[model samples]
Target: MNVAVKAPVSTLIQQAAGRIAPNWPLDKLIAVNPYWQMRQLSMHEVAVNLSWLGGVHVYGDVSHYQHVSDDDLAQALSALGHELTVAQFKQQPLKQPQPWQNVAQLADLERDSEREISWNDEVVHQISQFAGDYFASQPQTGAGCDDFYAAWLDTICHDHGLEILMKSKGLVEQFKALPSDATTLVEQALTMLGVTDEAQVDYLHALLLSINGWASYSAYVGWQAMLAGKQNNVVEQLLAVRLAWELVLWQQLSSSELQINWKRQLAHSNQLKGEHQAYVDGLQVWHLANEMQIQQGLHQQLRTPLPAKDNAALSLQAVFCIDTRSEVMRRALEAQSPSIQTKGFAGFFGLPIAYAVGSYQRPQLPGLLAPQLEVREASSGKLATAQYSAQWQKFAKSSAGGFSLVESTGLLYLGGLVKNTLGLGKAKVTEFGPLTLSKQGKALPLSEQADMAAGILGSMGFTDEFADTVLLLGHGSQCQNNPHEAGLDCGACGGQTGEVNVRLLCQLLNDAAVREALIERGIHIPDATTFVPGLHNTTTDEVIVLSGQVPEQIEQWLAGATEQASSERAKLSASPDAKQKARDWSQTRPEWGLANNACFIVADRKRSQHLNLGGRSFLHDYNWANDKDFALLTTILTAPMLVTNWINMQYNASVTDPLKYGAGNKTLHNVVGGNIGVFEGNGGDLRIGLPLQSVHDGQKYMHTPTRLNVYVDAPKHAIRNIIDAHDNVRWLIDNDWLYLYQLRDDGICRYHQGYWHPVQ
Candidate 1:
């Protein structure tokens, strides 16, 4: 193949590199859009780009062009109407998307489909496994870690991953000769590809895209770069090493049949242009338009006359994460206990603590933020059996113990598995610490603790007014054998349950010294007020109370609250099968994890209290009157609000293009390298985002794909200032990935082209 360079082909690689973000391992899974870096481009453009370059189908299934039901096809045709005439419409289901599978699937459909090239899947698997190990080889935190790339470069050079994989194939010498530094590595990779100058940037971007997840992880850690002005060296090094690895692999494949014509593929990709890109873009608009119409109806229906300036003092107040799943419970609990008001905030509750779970330190903050404080777990009182804990940990971590222990332990173990599998046994639950123990560490400084309390109160709109009994309600999901269990956990708490955050914050607020300092900070809590902690089992749709030493006057309220929650939930759920579903070992649809999320409203509870949001909106309570300087507004826009947009996009991509965006068919998924990641079937690339069952049910899709509709009740200038301050946010809004709405006393105004227009 006498392949010359394709076009100038100079800028694509760098452009793509800028767009990729990382996917965390399954244990610490956070919702992410796999095509996140490509968000700046139109869906059709991204779809076409991947198809030409990697033989990936971004808009449709690669297994085949997604099959549209006859009903869906009819509807589409009807929508097209005169544009696509009935007589000329030959639906007849487009031909088999491809005649071949696997390695040969890389052949471009629109280009030369006749030439089939063989790809070695086994070698690809081995390489991918090694890549997983390489990333995990270093300490979660390390010495001289100022630069991730610099640290990563050191790790790769010193590690045996590359050497081990190459030695058996007789490429150890060639691998060792590869440049160890990122700069020299990039230069060599570009030279190998016959690309130079600006094209080197394009080539580098393409190489990173080949293993985009790792590239994203480095960039993902440099998250503040999205808002900050500094460059992220770690991201640069990550991309460089990725390019270097591919270069070494390419050299090894040079003499094998597995070698692909690099220059030809690049040339072929560049030469291609989509004839129906505009049409595809147009077709995608209705889904977004439909979402807009639905949300507006709820906005109007849910709208209510504004409440009195001072919120009414309540018998009880509970705070929950602003997750869409929490929307239902908050609404239900309020109805069940009229005097018991409920508020929504981030699950982490402003305390970014790294929790001690066994021997590991898990960050209980959102993935976008780094952990700041470490909270250790200790066995005490009734839970003081450290010996039992050690034994349990060993059994849980050991694969042989998990299987053979049950086989040989006794009839009790053998019979238990059968009963559980048959769903006849009682449901098992994961229990945590008694949470009754408090740290005896030197009392945190009064100023720091007081400041934390004040911030929490101000952020949740709870200054001055205090309920008799306040509950900090944390939520988590329970399911058997689900690798993505962490995905269903609270995002604000890293990927763990919100229990620790709730318990710790409650203990901090309840401290007498903390209260004294909080008064000085101008946030007054009545002496009669006490904070209680509890959990809402989302999978079972049940509420469990873990009330500690609060004032003993809340016995009646607790009883009434639990009963009403159950009754209200029963009213909403069908057949009350949540518990059954939770217990089912192989159950796929484990409580509709963020399936229908659509709108995000950050305003006073009164603004959206009347409308039944159908668990589609993430509601965060904020009063514009209290936020005088826009500090609170800025934090909301940059953090919780931004996180909701991520959740929305992950669901959006999974539904719109499941095969390309989602980890298809959980049953076929094989977990790779312990908790590193999962590969679909045997091997290819590491899968990112939610699995298919998480998005689609067995019948039709449960989630409707839509860009996040953000409704912020604030002055237009305040919202505009926040937008102007962040370049990354502007990229999302200006590029049309999300819609921003500002609530004015007059009406709702939609933002477009740097201006606001009345929505109505």
Candidate 2:
């Protein structure tokens, strides 16, 4: 390849690699919008692009449209002001595919059709296995290599098994002729494939989508690097490796006739880039109609006029995460007594911090933001003993000792297995202690603590009111033998329990010096006011007090609240005993983690407090009056709202296209590389997103595939200003990734093209 042509090829490679969104690993797993990077394009464009590139669907199948009542479709069309009739819309073509197969896929279709093994499958398997070893939690024996591409090249060149497995005699020879560096390899591959400049991006992207799970995992490495103010080319390198595979296949299987077919396919792919307008338009209209119907139901729920402001002094005020699951607890808690009030805030409670235990550290805030503060565990002999025991357990489970240990301890493990199988074993809670603001061997100043306390208080709209005992309840879920346990935890806390952040915040708020500093800053904390930390166990709807001494009255209120909330949740769950579900090792559907979440309301809780949202809406308590200049509102829209949209879209995409977006059958999931991701039935591209069991219960889908409907209580102008200022935010709203609505005293108004239109 000529050096002059390398620049554009590299640019194309970079652009192609940008299409893959990051997939956080199992331990710190968080929901990510698979199309997040492509937000710059309209949702319709993405649907068309993905359809042609990978045969992926971006909306519900044609059956969904057929099943939806004609009246609902007509009303949805009317709501969106579309002129298309239900019959005409139904007649519109279903998702179409273009003849745009890559070299590996083409080879598999033409040359390897008679073979027992597919060339494409072999390529994905090889790459996925290499990725697993290269990024393994514990380094594999032969997985060592500094550069991603270089290691792959070295591994493939030496691996004689690949030639035998692929059943191609010249495969290793073709690989051996490849260039040393990723940039050079990519350039050469494009030149040999005769991929035109117009089609290079799409071609590269298609190659990546073939192994999307690993591509997404590599993108996560790059995402984390970028977050830390650095750049990582792992995604580009992985793209090059994928492209190289195509080049190898092209070399081994190409014929004069096949060469012409390849050229035609590339050209056709370029020509078909924007050719699905009719189908895409129909999808948009249908999706909007479905969303409108859901919105109408929510509107009815919020139709009751807001009750007159309650001035009665409260015995206690409890704050919970704005997560959809928290809505049930908050509602039930308030129902315990009129005097008891509840508020919702982001799960991490506005603390940008990471939690550290000995040698291990992880973020305790949303994935959108990097941790600025570090909270380290205080020295304790009990913690030391726990860490030592954990290390021994880790050693026993390692590849080297696992078989021997299992053989020796087979009888010893029987009792525990029986207990777990019978739902008698208690969930093991990791014990760690007294947290301090210490980063890199130094304790942070008291002023830093005071600053954090004041900022969170202000953002949470706690500037004016104070309760004698305010319980800050963070949430987590309990389940046995679940690799995706973190998925059930607080996403805003970076897929960890909110216990660390909430406990740390309570300590700061209770500090005498922090209180003195707050008073000086014009925010008053009543001396009698005590901040208590608690954990809301979503699995059982029980509140576990972590540190503070709760008032007798407040304890009684929490007991009543938990019982009522558990009863409400039991109706939706398979088993009435929530505790048994948590303990059951075979319980694939443990409490439906954020399954039906479709709406996010950023307004005072009073706006929808009386309505039973059925644990579907994420309620972030916001009082626009307290937020002068709309700074807090801007943060809410840009950060928390964006996070919720990611969560919503993760579910939406999983439900819409589970094969491409969701991790397959939980029963077949084999955890890849310890924590990177899972592989269904041992070998495939690493699975990402929620497993099928997370959103489906065998017969029916538990989650409705609705795009997020965000209801914000703010001036239309303020919402417009925020949207105008942020290009990504504008893309999400205007492109219909999610529906945005302005909550008003009169009625809810939907946002479209910089204007707000009132709902009927």
Candidate 3:
């Protein structure tokens, strides 16, 4: 049922540019794999092309790939079938463009000429203003993401025509009037600008390269059009304006006699040598080697007896997100007591709901998903009391405003600030609290809740195994002055805290009426078992009780989790002052933020029970035997596996090319539009991915940029059926974005080219 998009080459380029993700607001920050949609091209190919034409360092030359680990080098040589040794690498020519050929030299075409304005600056600024208005005017629930380009094309076509350019060389009329639609506009503008149809793609690439951040941001909104087999008109708007500007600028600089051949220059710039191919091979070898190391390690732990596999009477059972952060906590908790059991599920717990508070609605699920339900926060819980001050809310939100207000108060503010700094002063917030059962208010009807309960239980393979106290745990972080706070939270919850989804699901599952309906559907809950809602603070390493009283033994067991968390934290950083750095507002490195992540296994615990994952694997609880129809496995492959891949590549791109993809030095980042995005140094482009500090240490990268390795303990045919059925899944695996492994009785077998290759 997939629709094919039939378009001209010019339209294709615009659509491709528009498919790139835009950086979200600081509050809704999500990890995005920059090349997810462009998986048709290999990483090296994309990197090389991006660097050559865009002037962006997505991935550097042979020397850049040399940063791979020693083990990775050994693997690269064998897997790549390329000749690369230290001697040969030394002989390799530089992969990047020479100093003279670079586009940077094109800035000042004629030094002697008196130019009143910069064409690039003026066009970019004007376009940025138009883009901002177009996007900000529409809400997510409205047509804002798509209307910018449509409106621009319609308005411009009404006044401007080719006659305006025939009369005046000025860009004012060019901006004011234009052709009726994108195609006519682009064709006419190119004719006037002296750019031929053959060079339009290169021209579009050059223009998009300059304002890549804004273009990418606009593309993020255009995702809806791409999904519907339509081109992103907004990106076309960008292409049109910038292309028109080029025509006007060419007219202005016609007298300069600057011999600028954009097509010829770009053609020479994007060429790759045989040695550069070897360099790309070596980089892949390192990536493959890194992947192999994890697979071998995970395969080694396959036979370890899984806890609570049978219908054992467990004292406590807690379900946590399949995030890599939860893997360690699950292990620590299980080790605390033999009776304690842990299960990994998607943080949203199967209900795709947008978390809303009255008039304010936020996208709290995975940024990729279209929220199907709305869960509102009505009551303030405890914070709604009279003691809460309205001014304190503003103080908590804005640092500059709060500091100025406190400075005006002088001594009165001094005493309070000092007390707050000492951790004694409390400014109660009358907003954003724990979601209770009453607030849930049967969001999912009894039949719907019954259906969801079955899906959740069936996915986890928990049909009859109900514990004394079943805890649904979600995670969130608390930090000051951290713009990427949401990036540190649950990915399954759409970059927001997963506590609300977890609590609501727990309440629905524990309801007597819903349970009775589920029992008829063959899922039975024990009378003695009670479901509790909880949250895990990954930063502070604290487990907070949200609702329903827990047993005293469970409470005591939870209290000891802090010690285990500290032990894990010690392993993460050797520095004793690391904890102190977390409190430091100036510190950019809040946490590793899923660094060194490699494997995503959707199988039982026994597959990775004894191995020291080091918080690098995402463990989703799945029982293949229970999934006879393979629907759950299909969902996991398409949804969680795909989402995990995005997370993997986000870190990979950030580590490989921090200059372009990453938000440059955290110290220099200036918050743009309050919380919408960031600027590296006040102006150039919007900063998209994680800051450099999050991935790299002072010396080298903490995260090894590589593809995610996915291991599934399902029948080979089941895995194969879904992969063959879904083009998206097949594209990712076959395209080498991720590796798929089938867990068999004999050993782990990798799927490749319609055959299963045994893991070496």
Q: Pick the candidate with the highest lDDT.
A: 2
Q: How far off is residue 257 in model 1, in Å? A: 13
Better of 1 and 3 by lDDT: 3
The local lDDT score (0 to 100) that residue 193 gets in candidate 1 is: 50
Report the Cα lDDT for residue 650, model 1.
82
The residue-by-residue lDDT of candidate 1 on 1-760, one tens digit each, is: 3234443332333454666766677777788766667766755566555553444444432122133333443444564443554334433232212111112223222223344222333234444655566555644432222444355455555556555533335445555677656656655566675553434544455555555545554555455344234445455665665655566556654543434544544544334424233334334433433544565575585455664544445887888889997777777666654576779899889886777645666778887786656675555663447546756744533332445566677777667656765678864354445333222334346687678778988898888878877888788887766778888988888777888888777777888888888888888778888887777777765656664644444455554544544454454444356666675556766677788788888888777766668778898988888897999988988898778878988887677656545778888777655565677886776777788988765766777666788889898888898899986567667766778888656777888669887765
Which sequence of candidate numbers ranks them by TM-score, best first?
2, 3, 1
Alpha-carbon runs more than 4 Å astray in model 2 = 1-7, 65-67, 75-84, 91-95, 112-114, 137-146, 270-277, 389-408, 420-433, 439-441
Q: Put down candidate 2 lDDT per residue, 459-483, tens digits, no spaces.
A: 8878878899999989999776677
* TM-score, model 1 to reference: 0.79
Worst 10 residues of 1 by lDDT: 95-104
Q: What is the C-alpha lDDT of each candidate?
A: 0.64, 0.83, 0.67
Candidate 3 whole-model C-alpha lDDT, 0 to 1: 0.67
Q: Output the better candidate (2/3) by lDDT.
A: 2
Cα error of candidate 1 at position 106, Å: 6.9
Q: Candidate 3: how large is its RMSD?
A: 5.6
- Give the 10-residue window scoring lowest on summed lDDT in candidate 3: 98-107
lDDT of 3 by residue, 586-680 (tens): 55676776888888988877667666687889999888887779899999998988889889988977877676678888777666555556777
